[model samples]
Target: MSSAPAFRKFHLMRQRWSQLLFAHWPIDPALLRPYLPARLELDLFEGQAWLGVVPFTMSHIRPLGLPAVPGLNRLHELNVRTYARLDGVPGVWFLSLDATQPLGVWAARTLFHLPYLHARISLTQTGDTLRATAERTHRGAAPATFVASWTPGDVLPPAQPGSLQHFLTERYILYTAGANLQQAVRGTALWRGRLFHAPWALRQAMLTEWDSTLVESHGLPTPTGPPLLYAADALDVWVQELRRI
Candidate 1:
């Protein structure tokens, strides 16, 4: 498999992600195939598919060369996502993205054509443990909520290719679909967004506390058993503009 690709072209935005909790669960491929766009394929690792629910804080977010706005500079976000590939390019395909800030949600939806929803979200840190909560409040959308706490453990060596950790966290591109249009010739054209970031400084994570219905809210079966967990301290990211693929 290919490692993360570099973006030599101009990036449209920049942001910092911190205190991230990567929680994932294995799922049957059949459960997700029905929801994915016709042009995208569900990515798998060793014949198993996975779903992820990640919660974190984003800061210093602004378009390239622009000063970060006061209220929009930072916020909490939670996303329900899975892996996918389009024409041989691996990327993240989000089922839903919930953010505490409205403007951020609007920009993600309008500018990137992703499923961005407004939610009530909060994060607190105490010593080595972090607690996060998110409740989707977007009108006319299915309700989704997540509450969990995690503590970082020993730092792990970088994930080798083909490992589950690498499959779950090494993604750098994102694919999004625009609103469905019955008259459109290509019903499910996909858009690709590229991101540049340093390799993740990952550590084993202990799930100190948890409760969530975020996955089931998407009409998929509730994930059973504990989720695979990993934590990252922080990373600076540059995002490129979305383009048709």
Candidate 2:
């Protein structure tokens, strides 16, 4: 819905995202600038910048037209992200992505140039409540940990075109810089990947416990005050090829 993909249909993989919690906090745009590639413009909503800590489950992951491998298809994923734009197109810019699967991390880093790090993570759900935990265990990487629990409440319709919820959750493109990847690889300037998914089935959510070092891991200050929380129902996704942009 960010105006980039037209259901392009030529995807690299198919995956499902479920039991997701989107936790967001407003931040000073200046504080996030140093961490972004110069080529990207930090995207803002009414002159404000936001950072999100998202915990979700990835399952049924497999290459296009291939069957999912039994052991490797499911993973626990958590990411810290901010918004950005490139060539007038808006998208997400990841600060870090921690995953439970080692092979999945390697494939994402090498193929998509994302900042995918290895971590110990788990997720559990019962009725309308979910609990999640994560700790970065990748060798030589900055240590970051998160623990949280929440209950989904009051199903909401898809966000309208101009609403804050739409700005915060409906991103369909993502940008990555090879040099900024976790392992310090160099040379590629910038890359963009487009994805296609249906409108999110959302629910208002309440977080009983919210604590993380994900934002601080990038040397940014811990944001104060309660965060904006939303829970999304499962959506199947189509990830297209990552191309230098």
Candidate 3:
């Protein structure tokens, strides 16, 4: 019998969900280097996957005239010194949405990686949910769309690194479900500004354990083709455990 896939503990580093849709564009590698952390690391596979992380840090403060409430600054922000990585394949790019800004445009043109990026993000409003969608063009010809909706939780628990769904959900909720998977993920300008979404308000609740090397997925085929399919049906299904890793 085969062993089940173990999910790693998740880090509740972010909360708000911001989705992006990219249509046709090219990215430059050199342009990305400057934005990455000095001590960053990367592992690349031809036109397929690239995994790496750069250091990151961000602060929040209202502009001179903006309101100074506890959480009200999603207009202008800044992301500093953050590290991120990705494992992108044909349709798998649909699963990664980690950063606030759409940094994938530069990667596609330069690395020929995750040629297209797309997705949507849901926010919390008076305990209800508010969603926003964004993206950029990559493939130079193809069009793609990514979407997700989430409810707001007052307390986003730290994901157990070994909990694939938990960790991944936290990751997507915090990082990769909106942009180019192959692109380097970074802190967004929103962090330095406001906390318009639940994801942004939960950044300080991170607790990391040992780095995990386990990856698992619950993927489904698409009606359009193999390149376009739904990963799962439940948008609100709380991750239980991976049937396989």
Candidate 4:
């Protein structure tokens, strides 16, 4: 895996993430190019591209000087994403980020310059299993839904560099091109946000149930093969303010 940027002395946001499920499907690079800005190249491995559907929950979300409000602090999130590079700086490029909180959605979109949408989502834990259900409910946005139940298995060591797992899950920066994904096709403002977090304490996750329409919502075909799945329990994170790229 790669290292993060120099740690920021101050961060605009602090949040804790839990029950993260990372599901990736390999796809043709050409299929994703049109969704990103022409200036950004698809970050590929072994001449292949990947699409990821990640489901997780966020807690204690707060801006630098503020207290976390009770009604707006906790939410479930699901994102459709891919990897990309701008001048060789690799980072995540999201197609859509669906969250259960409307105010959080608006705040993210307005302040971060990222695509964030409202959705109906729930994530529950029973014993060692996690069950999640999500449906995009944003008005006029592309419809999507996800259902999954998985149990974390044996813990794995940190991913080594050049490995598929490393390439897919070890990202620390994110690139955003526009307020929405559709606006990026023709070119728009491009920004980068740096995140600082320790290496994921990853584990193999056994899927007992899985179904999703996130990729198809973007006009991509359903992945023909089963997704590669990995899980992480919790991590504290810091997000720097977005900077023009």
Candidate number with greatest TM-score? 4
Instruction: Give lDDT tens digits, candidate 4, residues 14-103.
Output: 888999999998999988889898888999999999999999999989888788999899899999999999888999999999999998
Q: After TM-score superposition, what is the CA distance of residue 158 in candidate 1 from its true location, in Å? A: 0.8
The digit string of per-residue lDDT tens for model 1 on 1-245 reads 12323652467888889989999999999998876887889999988899999999999898867889999899999988999997788899888888999888888888788788889999999999999988889987789888999999999999888888888999899988863212111465778898888778899999978888888877899899999999997888889778987
Report, for every candidate in turn, its global Cα lDDT versus the true structure.
0.85, 0.87, 0.24, 0.89
Candidate 4, residue 145: how far the Cα is off, in Å: 1.4
Candidate 1, RMSD to the unseen true structure: 3.7
Best by lDDT: 4
Q: Clashes in model 2: which pairs?
A: none
Show pairs that collide, candidate 4. Answer: 1-161
Tell me each candidate's TM-score.
Answer: 0.93, 0.93, 0.27, 0.95
In the range 114-201, model 2's lDDT, one tens digit per residue, is 8899999989987878999999998877899999999998899879977889989999999888625533323447888988788898
- Candidate 1 stretches with Cα past 4 Å from truth are 1-9, 179-186
Clashing pairs in 1: none
Of models 2 and 4, which has the larger lDDT?
4
TM-score of 3: 0.27
Q: Model 3, range 1-245, lDDT digits (tens) per residue?
A: 02212321321112221321111111233433443323232212232222221111122322323443453323211111112343331111222222233433343223332222322222222333323232323243233333323333343344454432232222321222213322333432111111122121121111111121111111211212111101111111112211110
Order the candidate numbers by TM-score, best to worst. Answer: 4, 2, 1, 3
**True-vs-predicted CA distance for residue 213, candidate 3, Å:** 29
